[model samples]
Target: RYDVDAIHMDDYFYPYPIAGTPFPDDRSFSRYAASQGFSSTQRGDWRRNNVNLLIQQIKYTIAAEKPWVRFGVSPFGIYRNKRSTPDGSGSETNGLQNYDDLYADIKLWVEKGWVDYNLPQLYWEIGHKAADYTTLLHWWNANNFEQPLYIGQDLKRSVDKNELDVKIRQSREMSFVQGNCYWYGYLMLDNYREVYDHLRSQTHRAKALIPAYTHMHKGRPAKVKKLADVFTEDMHFLTWEHPKQPRNPETAQRFVVYRFRKGERVDISRAENIVKITPDNFFVLPYESGKSSYTYVVTALDAFHNESKPATIKVKL
Candidate 1:
């Protein structure tokens, strides 16, 4: 019953291997592998298939229940080493792989469109001995297959090496990489090495909307109606009404508020102009002395981040 935007699975599909000891799934494999047409020799394939089945089932369930809720995977950085794959469709780095070691066919899942997005955890520093961050970053970008790809960075490593700025800049340079997610977000909240200040003042100064899922739904929601300002002794706010229609893809799930100076053009496309994005229809206006007037534009956003036409209102203080 929780209202969640996405269902995410991290890199925990199977247990990491213990040296000189097997995974101890022999009994389960022996009991059910044959019924699925998997031979005893194909135990590894069977294990990968099990994870594949789970991914497919989750995709189907989300599509049926809430098509707007995206299904994404943050898999282990390396899919496979080149030496392990027959076709050599693997990265050059030699490391434990999601495909072989963890029995997760991440490439297959992405290619088959079974997941909405893939964020590979490349938690290594640049030019590392085993799994270099830049090497795997480029590898994932090349194999994204038009699916959204985000990088999962380790907060401590990036900050300690002073590569946080470098890594973010590198991802932005790549065409297919959409964004980056930090591991152990608390480090950022705690402002480790002033990383939070750096992001707020420089890298992420402008507000950005989540990328729209055009693959699922390409339609925009209807624009809001009756946009007006309300002024009272205790509070001054702007309020608008949703479009008169039944709840559907064309109905507003949230609203985007943008503010522009009196003489400036009302451009909703500019991320810097965005004041707030909220589910509530009302937005509290901050009082600013010496500011005589300002123009505010509100737009409706559907579940997929598609925005509607702007509803404008000018306030004179």
Candidate 2:
């Protein structure tokens, strides 16, 4: 009984083209192509069909089990070059095309709603000749089949302020482009090139809720049934209870705690006002004041991060 939230596939569908070595799928194709109604020259089409079937099958199986779980794919940034496929390619680069070279129909998968999100590995810098990051970023953002778009960023190249600043500006300017994820985990943990400090102080100062997948599951979670607070010797703890709906995809999977000054407006959507997002019902607040009155609000987040109405409680410490 392992609970999984998301399934992600990277850009290894078909290996990159070497100089002269073939991919060596001939035997498998010969065995199944005739029965499946494909000819010898239709090897490319059959291979693409095989990958497409696997993609759709995985999506359906995940939906049948847990509708909230998302299936995402990170394909090579260059789907096709305009020179090769006039009708299919949009970008101006001559890099290896995922559709033609790798036999991966990534655009089709996104257009058919088989994948929840598409994160293209647009890892090059802005002025690169072959695979420009800026060019590909705009290309994918414009063609996003109405799903969330997050780019796979390169930490090494983005260490330069000029490069990172441009990426940050473009990512924020594009409305559909949600965010970007670093390529590797250790780079972030090790703070390689002080990239972590720059992110913490500038880009990620406050916590934010993940973008919701509204197409999979919509509507707000049910409000909490009880909200109360308790005070220890030097710590403050807030506890809550919600109506049970374990199997319902719209049920609360977590709670967001918001704290406000007595006279300040209690805006739960504001990132600065949020204290924490907790899986458990209780949260421990920082000991800021002993004689201050605080207004706290708790909201429920469903499996897809759809938030519910707030339940407010005031405490005078």
Candidate 3:
């Protein structure tokens, strides 16, 4: 009944085990284990399979109903410790793992394409005793399994330790780590430790479009048409016509407006050049007294963020 861009799952899969007490699931497991063809010795496998089935069912159901909506999971930072895995596919950290403690096979989910994206919550400091942030960051980047990998940063820990900027720079350096999601939105919005200032002035200086889901739909929408300027009393507006009705991925659901000085080269690839990304076909132009001439380029973006060709218009004051 409601439309959403994506469905996301957080790190809480199975509860952390209590010391000296096993999970009281023997009766339930015995009832359905044989029907599912699981032996008593495969209890751990059965637990992992339960979570796996949930992931697969959600993916399939979303695809059947709304194919455009993406499914992503943010699992615990450590998939497994090297000491636990004989194949040496795990990280070097000595921490509670998603595989052993939580019974979440996040790596298998990513490899099987059950989740569209994987974001590991690496909330520890750079050189934490149990789970070093950098160590797990590099580990996740290497084992992304050809899926989009984003880092889940704990805002308080990063700000308190004065390593937020360093972590951002480090993630940018890794080729496979696409982005970072700050945990606890209220802290950032409240400007905890000047994080909001840091982001606005340094890290996130310019507007940016969300990464396009090219793996799902690579086709670009049709370019916008009839680009022109409109004047209403004292307001200057840039307007364009939609290439097609905004009903599907092939039509324009949003537009990207980029402004450049008359002598400057037009480059839409630069996020700094982006003026506004809006669903409206008209943009209210901000008049500058000294700037008499400017060049503006507009492009159409579909729901999947697939961009169309440029529609250029030069405006004279």
Candidate 4:
């Protein structure tokens, strides 16, 4: 798990098909039907059970390895369409549901303390005739338990009316949500400039550490124990060290460098400007003249995405 911080399982592993291809599940289905007494009409139910098992297993894997680390899953926008069942997740559109189509029992995963957080991909807006943002927001709110809840807004669909309502609701949800995860760190790139505007603004991401995952484990980094070195001659290099985070350190994949630019804490989130580092529980920033004009800090993020508070270094001018 050290390969990544925060298990960002997107709508992958099993993708929805194109017009010609079918989701090849005959072998799994036959086995499942034989083992669980599942009938053809009940295939969706069996599939859901399978996904639940996967979630539960992964949860145990994290617990056994590093309980405090974080886990996240970005599911399809619709869990279930209203017309399909009595307890349908009433949203617009008769689309494939995560609960039914993909077999992911997302809501129950949260209620049962299996997943650390959930970022439902609600790309539609409030006024949308189908799959309105308000509908899913309320639906998610009603079911939130000990875990965190975040909305995954899509950048491509951002400029559209239904997508814009998502931005409005995103702010509103924060009062109730843990945080919102922008779909792909890159999608909010140039292609989705309008939607990117909504996220890059100063008004967004107002919190530090989106509510703690109480269900996983509450672990803190050992303190910013020392600032070892600072260089400023040719370029600049600053180094700081600390003990491992609460979870097993191996699960940490990368670190985010934070610089106190004129007292404003700035994290390099852009692709071109950003520097990647191994999640070794230490931060080393190569000096850049125009980078910033303040102190520097470092934080560790594990594969399950347990982020440490900034370990600061004040650069002497």
TM-score per candidate, chains pooled: 0.92, 0.92, 0.96, 0.63
* Model 4 misplaced regions, further than 4 Å: 1-3, 12-32, 37-41, 66-69, 87-94, 160-171, 184-187, 191-198, 205-207, 219-317
Best by TM-score: 3
Q: Write the per-residue lDDT of candidate 2 for residues 1-317, one digit (tens) a residue.
A: 56878999999987888989999988899899989889988988888898899999999999899888999999988988878875855688879988888889988998998999999998888878998888888888888876889988888778754577678788778868998888787888999888889889988888899988887777888898689898889777888888646677789989898889989998876898887888889888666557889999999999898998999999875
Over 1-317, each residue of candidate 3 has an lDDT whose tens digit, in order, gives 77688999999888888899999998989999878989989888899999999999999998788777889998989999999999988899998999989999998988988898999999999989899999999999999875788999999999999999999999999988888999999998899988899889999999998788777788998888999999889899999998556447557888999998889999998999999999899999987784588899999988788899999999975
Put down candidate 1 lDDT per residue, 1-317, tens digits, no spaces.
66788999989998999899999888999999999999989999999999999999999999888878899999999999988889988888999999899999998998988899999999999999988999899999998897889999998999999998999999999989989999889999999988899889999999888887777788888778999999899888999999533236557888999999889988887999998999899999988883579999999888878888899999965
Please report how far candidate 4 places residue 176 from its true position, in Å. Answer: 3.8
- Candidate closer to the true structure by lDDT (higher is better), 1 or 4: 1
* lDDT for predicted candidate 1 compared with the true structure: 0.90
The alpha-carbon lDDT assigned to residue 179 of candidate 3 equals 89
Instruction: Kindly give the stretch of ten consecutive residues in candidate 1 with the minimal lDDT sum.
Output: 243-252
- Candidate 1 displacement at residue 238 in angstroms: 2.3
lDDT of each: 0.90, 0.86, 0.89, 0.62
**Is 1 or 3 the stronger prediction by TM-score?**
3
lDDT of 2: 0.86
